[model samples]
Target chain A: GLAAPAIAQENPKISWRLTSSFPKSLDTIYGGAEDIAKHLEAATDGNFTIQPFAAGEIVPGLQAVDAVTANTVEMAHTCSYYFWGKDPTYAIGTAIPFGLNGRLQNSWFYQGNGNTLMNEFYATQGIYGLPAGNTGAQMGGWFRKEINTVDDLKGLKMRIAGMAGKIVEKLGVIPQQIAGGDIYPALEKGAIDAAEFVGPYDDQKLGFEKVAKYYYYPGWWEGGPVVHAFINLEKWNSLPKHYQAALTDACAFANTNMMARYDMKNPQALKQLVANGAELRPFSQEILEACYAAALSVYEEISASNATFKKIYDDQLAFKKDAYLWMQLSEYTFDTFMMIQQRAGKL
Target chain B: GLAAPAIAQENPKISWRLTSSFPKSLDTIYGGAEDIAKHLEAATDGNFTIQPFAAGEIVPGLQAVDAVTANTVEMAHTCSYYFWGKDPTYAIGTAIPFGLNGRLQNSWFYQGNGNTLMNEFYATQGIYGLPAGNTGAQMGGWFRKEINTVDDLKGLKMRIAGMAGKIVEKLGVIPQQIAGGDIYPALEKGAIDAAEFVGPYDDQKLGFEKVAKYYYYPGWWEGGPVVHAFINLEKWNSLPKHYQAALTDACAFANTNMMARYDMKNPQALKQLVANGAELRPFSQEILEACYAAALSVYEEISASNATFKKIYDDQLAFKKDAYLWMQLSEYTFDTFMMIQQRAGKL
Candidate 1:
């Protein structure tokens, strides 16, 4: 039993700054940090305060991870996959091709080996991590033309990141690694034939429907994409365990809030997108099957070279196998029946 | 902009007690309160500690609601549906037949009107509620015989709870409300032919598979049963705002943990049960269809009698329609495709 030590009444006020990978234009994603700050301050009697800065305010969005690692900033909220360029393992922290969904991702993190594994990896980066938010499953991307077969993906220039880009390269697609702020202009200028940002809510705000009429279903590359807070490892440990718990609890609250906000906002934004002439289409079976094959090969190749990656990836793979099997019999069965009934106007 | 006033340095020591409906033997369910207490103590710098007691230790499991209302204890963790006998609206706080899954339940409670509506109703009971834990979707129950049609349910005696009993009654099934400790014995003795508790993890612990060979899945009545912490309203109001926030954040942490723990545990528990000769089965389509129709009518009748039930039910029903629509197009599609590919050994 871990008995509590006696309470010591003395307290010290502290202030910290958080750098976010998101620009203010995407309120739901960026506001996750603000949610953490607000709750932390409220929880601590205002004894602690954290101010959040948008991308480029303190450092470029992609560089927030480095900023936190360098101890130049106290904390940051960003998509971990953004740093996969430094190490492929980072992508698994956020999302991977045909990876866990939002629900499964949380199960992995809080319940399985994910929390400890990711934290250990972050420790090597001189950072400590807490999940702040997830975008659920994202739309594949917005394309100028509908994709009908695997051939439609060949030679297609698309703006994407992380392992998804690497796997798509095998499909003969040219992968363009564009930053968040520049993706819109890149797509509009036809520099990239397609781009995958988040789902309907964020995509609508970026006006993707105006430039591309074909909006695809399921971003296989980034289902349940987690956005997390990266804290300087030394700084995190320096805080009292009490403060650590407060920060972690606040992060959990923010995690649930982000997904809920997106679920609420996306349905309406999607309707508006359709009304504004966006075409909703599921990825053709041929394309999905091809990508699934490419993804498996890519995973195997990467795991061969990276021991750390192999360890974490293998753990998730087993968890995913069992989880999907159970979900198929339970969640998927009910959902399928209900959906069919709904379509028939019986529900 | 709600700016922090100023950091106050003084704090007071506090101690509280939490009674849980779960027994200590069921670590996954019972551990949810421990998680909350652990986080709360750490967040409050050990200035606050909450000691947890299992059911029957303080008050009998089902009496937790009344105990909290009467301030027999400062707080209690239990299934809200356990109190549906007090008010049918209580069942909605936890789950309803064909209601939201865990993911959607969180969205409804935190992001939709559920929080406000549930809190408002709790106010009348002199209580304050916070969602502290959730057991994702549950298995229907363990039955001694397979159910092939609605006729199979005719005159069947089963131990179930919430409004599920009322709906089952419509199909000529006899529903029995059995206590946690007595359910296994009753089932073993053929006093009850079927029993639904939680998922594989807890059910296996109770040795249900030894007595019942047929294990059915997708408990429609409990897609995502949320177990909450009920605090005496007067005690909650008396806490400093800082402490209140600490408690709320801690509850959020536990909410994520409960589902994750169950997800991580149930897969193995289920596999073990199956190896032990427990046959896995899905409810027949005829039976599900009949239950669906009965559930709808039961809901209507209850709402017609209880305005409180109507208000909350209407809000959730609207939310469910929109949520399901979006999920069908996005989440369900991806899951269905991915699951099929995985089963074909392609994913």
Candidate 2:
């Protein structure tokens, strides 16, 4: 009687729909959206469920944010920077040129006030965000020839993302914003001289090695890029407390899973890219110096015009300072030794 | 032309000390290690070089795995799984028993793993580990907990870890294996019910967790757990291959850096426990029967003893497969409806 009585009192079922900015081709990033849905359903014992849609399946790829804002979809998985055209502050939610790398960004979000600050910014845009995934620190871009000096950047056409494009623009280079699926065709046809994506793993999958022979180091633009789950504010609030907690927990899991998958897959891909004649080159000193200078100028310009951006930026920069200091003593010292050995073949 | 040749031949006086398992901690796992060290040193010019060290450290944590492993005395930061014994795994890693709640575990590791794992697993033995971080899964210690009637496990003192001791063993408990630091106190106090450390994370931290928990699981033993770094391995091999590749790329960036740390940390620690609380627990019909007949036998034990653990587990149980299938339909369905509704709450 006790078992039957308890069984009869079941929780009500709830369902959800999620749209993703990535195509299934980028499994890890796109896969994060899918994972969130599954965990939500399972955790709630099927009482709650979510459905996912890929970029362009239900709406245009670039329109994810607008759609969520307009209530066209209940939720969307996307990088906040894509909507920077609406507000530059959104860029901080995703990445910034030479900003915090993935781990630090995560610290900023969960431990520091990053999540809270970014969410406040998102609120102004009519959405809320959960850090769903990250691409760690990224590579600069794939180039057709080695970048030997600052002059190499002038007149070059590059497919970069968000605010980095603005910074690069100041350096006399032309910047283009294109989706992941379109990068290869453009590179192959010479429509764009360069393109930047998450590190070796995803870049290889997109077949950048075939079209670009010189892969440069350090994606200064997106030191640590975060992908977000943009949820409709009103809807998010309506969910039962348990469902909300479940979604948050699932997103955390998805975020970590994405990083691990990338770590495992990138090494082999990098080795393969090199074997395919992709020459890995460091960014020229002059060019790096120029970009660093330009990045500072852009930061000043944004700070001058955007109050919200300045608030988050100021705090983030401060945290980065402390994190860097601590790392210098531990992470930095240890890593330096290893790189030298790797180059020397003693490793 | 003459000026160019001199500049080219200058070959910047660059050097670094990296502590890692892989050459670099890029690709997310190791990439982070490589990127930070390389970026920092480069950013500051050759004045700052980082040397990396791999898993065995300069030698090996089992050999001498910590900062001592690489000899980069400036500092060594990493997980606690690499040094299982000298103490119990619980001291260094956090996968033991019901353990601290997940969030609590994070605090414990950052705040607790530092002292506990180090003092119990490393310090007393002349090595050291830090709570550089976590990965987070961790199911209830795989249990042979008998439940057909609940009385079957009486006096079944099993190896368990952390707090899970009191909960499960409560049903007629006999917990044991507290971690290196905690173990002496607990075993001496006879407070344990049963215990578990981690598959590898806390395992090397030591199998003492295994002493009483009887080490049962679906790993189910560890759904997902944090790993650690154990330093010593001849003070991590007498340093200076960039302090042994910055201590082998900071233990290959804590090897996963957390996972690899756990991997390296678990072996030697487990080896040390041959005579201690090392009995494996078998799920009794009463316990298995009460849990799930399908649950008990369906746990992929066939894969437990062979190459299948390596191969089939990822494809079949690693979250990707089921998550993929379920998200495809359910998440898609729910998100579509929710997105269309403008009033949903945002994250």
> What C-alpha lDDT values do all the predictions have?
0.88, 0.55
Docking class of 1: acceptable
For model 2, residues B194-261, the per-residue Cα lDDT tens digits are 34433423342433344343444322223234444445545444432333322322232232234323
Model 2: residues with Cα > 4 Å off, grouped in runs: A1-10, A340-347, B1-83, B86-347
TM-scores of chain A, one for each prediction:
0.95, 0.93
Interface RMSD of each: 4.2, 25.0
**Top DockQ hit:** 1
- Tell me each candidate's RMSD, in Å, in order: 3.6, 24.6
* DockQ scores of all models, one per candidate: 0.48, 0.02
Model 1 chain B, poorest ten-residue lDDT window? B1-10
Model 2 earns a TM-score of 0.54
Task: Score every model by TM-score.
Answer: 0.96, 0.54
- Could you say which candidate leads in TM-score? 1
